[model samples]
Target: MKLKDSAIRPTAIAVQSPASTSTGTTAGTADRAADRTRSGVLLAALGVASFSLTFPATAWALEGLGPWSLVSCRMALGGLIAGICLLALRVRAPARRHWPALCAVAGGTCVGFPLLTTLALQTSTTSHAAVVVGLLPLTTAAYSSVRNRTRHSRTFWGAAVVGAAVVIAFAVQQSGGSPTGSDLYLFAALLVCAAGYAEGGQLAREMPGWQVIGWALVLCLPVAAVGAALALPAEPVHLTGHTIAGLLWLSAGSQFVGMWVWYRGMGAIGVARASQLQLAQPLLTLVWSVLLLGEHLTPAAPVAAVAVLVCIGVTQRARG
Candidate 1:
């Protein structure tokens, strides 16, 4: 008796070798995926470390510089560095289609978030700013979900809510039991910063990460330069070593290099998982705040940190 074609097909499929070419290709693809994931996590961690100093450094520099002056100078300097890099590398201008996305990048990091954070730091301690900025990763994740039209599990949303509560509690405890105007500014900064992160990460999928930031900086050059010029003090900058050091770090590390790596990581591992790595940033920022800005951490700070960390971990494990 002869078997039908469907019966024969089933036997043939069932007898397929594990070491077949197709299976080998699948295994190789998975290995590459794993490698990309590991590389992206490391890059994200480095980016986070570079950014950890920002709030502390900005607060320290605000002692000598006006908020507008600090924001303008940082943007101008960052733009110059990015321009020089683009020229030296001979990177072509991004396609005109990318201009809108570049505008989003410039608006968020170069203009909105930096300006708002500088103003906020003029009135807030680095420790308080760190707690407020801790809310950023969740914001980024939320934006990512909306942009991708993906749904995360209820557990993930729950974890985010818990994390937000911890941040609010920490902010209140640090602010002597009430929210302040500075917290409001930092909240605004988070909103803009998250938007930028998501948009830049999306752009990075199609272009080089460095090119994305470099172009964004170049696009904002005129505005940044003009703002810095107008905001310049009539008196010569009597630069203190600490203030100058802070400004340079903000210009070189946080504005340019950190963003380059961050976008690349987001492109590689995706915005959602990459943003999870940022949960470590606020903790690191507090360390920098204590050592650099002489801000003392409150008793509740550690509790908040632990709670946020647990929430982040839970969110990562939850289905999306």
Candidate 2:
């Protein structure tokens, strides 16, 4: 009887094994793939919305606050929120060796980028800033290829040159009248911010995307805070309802939530695909500028948008 039972058990195991194993594996793989796709879509949407409002929010805040003050306050608030999240998640502290890379990204993205965009919006319309920012990917790709010692195709260079020409042409066309000192300051800010973005993207490849940005904001807080404090004495600081709301949106929506979603999307789908999603930002900015600031969408807006779209497509294909 015992020998008969053992033989029966072997046959039963064999009969059940293949069907259950295959079913479980297929279901698990499907679930994971679905999750990744969902996450990617959510992240991309969040990044687009958050980034679109960036210029409008900055423009609103700068109505009362100085550029440095607005930037400093936003960074400080964002850093605080990120710190809480890191603590809640029990994320491990980054290694010492990563400090330089982290600082570079923080200074560039959190401090440098926002600071410049704010200053730019002080004189330029959100539409103008959007146009300038649309060129960010091209700048980043150019920097990456150079830094990585990778030779880009002629097409990549051509697209970059053409896109740059569009930006320059727009600037020149806009510059026919007397440009203010503030406008020059804004252009300087755009250049610096672009450098920050290129540096941040490179670092993001090595470090956890969230942590890289999180730490960068943390590092930049002190610098921003100090600058804000110094600038406060000379500026007429007023905290109006519009300014407060603008600050809240920029800090919470754009810096904190937007960046986390962006980095997460970058992790799930590679940066190249995630970046194409940013193409929506400029057009959205144009819309928002019209609605929020009553600024007209210039005829050049459509042309600039097309140029940015073409550049984004070219860059994405090149990356692939």
Candidate 3:
């Protein structure tokens, strides 16, 4: 009886109480959530960095290729890269139910944004066009809220508005204080691209992030092929080292790989939070414009940069 009692006491001491287990579980959950947030922020930042160079790259490409040829070739090249990746990995096609969203991704990012923005780049300088694209965060957030039925805090909204104002101010100053025809194309690009981004963010939740962009790229191949076929013959191309390099970056970096991590980050965080990071994109673009495109850097640029950073910090902190 003494031996049996001693063994039972030891067994009881080895077991944890329900309260202790619950507390441990909760702590683990919090740690994981924090890790995810950090990862998402880093990933989103990379995507923004990649995207920041896009306007400059487009400018470089435009030195040789016509707007239609540039857009069509870039899309086709990007799609081919993505399709090869999918084939190599043996990734399955997304469910038929997912096609509509994929089409939106294809139509907006692959077709609309590229075409409009390329056309705008013909008339607008990269610096001017970039600040216009600065509104993307707000547009994307609004689209996500409406489409996904998620709401953000007032803090988030405030920061987004402030950031947008700073960008618009810079754009207005750069453009000589009036709207132009190119502004129309840029604004249209923003709306369509926002739609693509919002849909891609949601789709990332259901599949691997790379796969989402990969499939979207693949799905648009037919359209891109047709565009390239028609546009290449009609439009002119004068390929140079700068143009080739720019085209490669546009196809590989901006279209596929950057967006792959972007969607992943959006899935880790929320679309709204992830997008707030893009407020920095214009300032980054400003730097690229100065370095790569030899565009002038104005005194107001430094001030706007600081303000946008503060706004990004505030938006990131808000729970929404």
Which candidate has the top score in lDDT?
A: 3
lDDT on C-alpha atoms for all candidate structures: 0.84, 0.70, 0.91
Taking the candidates one at a time, how many backbone clashes does each contain?
Answer: 0, 1, 0
Question: Between prediction 2 and prediction 3, which has the larger lDDT?
Answer: 3
lDDT tens digits by residue: candidate 3, 71-167: 8888889889998998898888889988898889888888899899999999998989999999999999999999978888999899999999998
Query: Could you give the candidate ranking by lDDT, starting with the highest?
Result: 3, 1, 2
Clashing pairs in 2: 106-216
- What TM-score goes with each of the models? 0.90, 0.77, 0.96
lDDT of 2 by residue, 24-132 (tens): 9999999997798568657766877888988888888888888777887888888887787778888887789777767766766687778767776776777766765
Which residue runs does candidate 3 get wrong by more than 4 Å?
Answer: 1-12
Please give the RMSD to the true structure for each candidate, in Å.
6.1, 4.8, 1.9
Q: How much is the lDDT of residue 296 in candidate 1?
A: 83
Q: Which predicted model would earn the best TM-score?
A: 3
Which ten residues in a row are the worst by lDDT in model 3? 4-13
Candidate 1 residue 164 Cα shift, in angstroms, is 2.3
